[model samples]
Target: MIDSHAHLDLADFDHDRAELFNAMALKGINSALIPAISEQRWENQLAIAQQYHCYFALGIHPWYVPEDINASLVSLENMLAKHAANDRLVAVGECGLDKLKPDFDRQQQLLSGQLKIAINMEYPVILHGVKCHQELLSLLNRFPNPKGGVIHGFYGAPELASRYIELGYKLGIGGLLLNPKAKKLRKTITELDIKHFIIETDSPSMTPYNATEKRNTPLILPNVASEIANLQKKTTVFILERLNKNFSQLFELS
Candidate 1:
């Protein structure tokens, strides 16, 4: 299985990241995509990906839009160009809009620039949206990523999901699936085709329901798959295989 999105680069896992990766590998979670949160995090994210033999993405997240947006975009472009030949840099985000955050205008600007770069670099994007799906959809329409992308941590309605899938994007399903209280999200997942979804843990955040600890990890992925199986009335293996296939197709993995 592949964790389509995870922040294993964060310091939350520093104490035992190596051991954690081993645990994930032992559990058959062979790969994960660690996306950058900001310019400051890009180097560390890249280092972790190299050491752990995983893939990563580079872009300024809406929450971490730099003060000098133009300079950051230039740096992002240069870094993307430098890593263009490397397969480890699989996408161009963990970037998108979040209405909950301030400076909506800057977020849009940063996202616009990243979308342009993703198109030029010919890379799929790993997107994040919080209460800004309509705005995100509008921006995507304006600056579409021809390589396609995933809307990470999707918790929208079935109709909203169809909108993204129709645009050739996949939805990233994570801890939200394990939440028994998320009735609407559960229904949405069930209504959509499994091929349109990819599993994620969003580790160190989006902790799964009834989790022993507050901090989430990739180890919870099987539970997620199991939950999806229950919702779809399919076997866990089938869910895993299908999600892995979806991940491979979206990220251009083999």
Candidate 2:
């Protein structure tokens, strides 16, 4: 299984990154998509993907936008161009709106800019919307359909989630579903075709059943896969096979 989203460049995995990769290999997590947070981390993100077996996603995250928008955008475009043809750089993001934090206007502009890039290049996007689905949906409404992507760290309602579905995007189910009290989260997943579902750890953030692994790395993918299997009422093996098939289908990876 591919961990659809993770941050191996983050300091959380610095001490044990190699061990974590070994664990991911043992668990059969064949690949991961490490996304750049800002121009600051894009180089490190590329280096990690080169050293590891994973791929990288490039874009300036909403939170990183500063006062000089034009200059920052110029820099971001330069970064995107540098690795435009790199086979390991799959899709564009860890990018999207986050009204849950501050500077939402900035988020909107950055998200729109990245969406334009995704639309132009036909690259599937990796979103990070939080507490702003309506605004996000509205912002995305302006863009044309066939939105190639998944909304990472997804915890929105089924109705709003359907909007993304209608736009040809997948809803990601991750560590949050592990909580017993996640009745609403499970309800949303149960209501969808499991094929449209993408399982992710958002590692270094959303640790699944093994919360004991405080750093949240790809080693937890088997547990995340198991949790998803239990939620979908299928055996782990069946779920893994189906998950890999669906992932390959969505990302156009074999």
- Judging by TM-score against the true structure, name the best candidate: 1
| Global fold similarity of model 2 (TM-score) | 0.93
Model 1, range 122-150, lDDT digits (tens) per residue? 99999999998889999999987778899
TM-score of each: 0.98, 0.93
> In model 1, how large is the Cα lDDT of residue 9?
96
Q: Please give, for residues 18-77, the per-residue lDDT of candidate 2 as tens digits.
A: 988887888788788888788778878888889997877888788787677677667766
> Which predicted model would earn the best lDDT?
1
Model 1 lDDT-worst window of ten: 245-254
* Residue pairs with backbone atoms closer than 3 Å in model 1 (clashes): none
lDDT of 2: 0.79
Clashing pairs in 2: none
The C-alpha lDDT values of all candidates are 0.90, 0.79
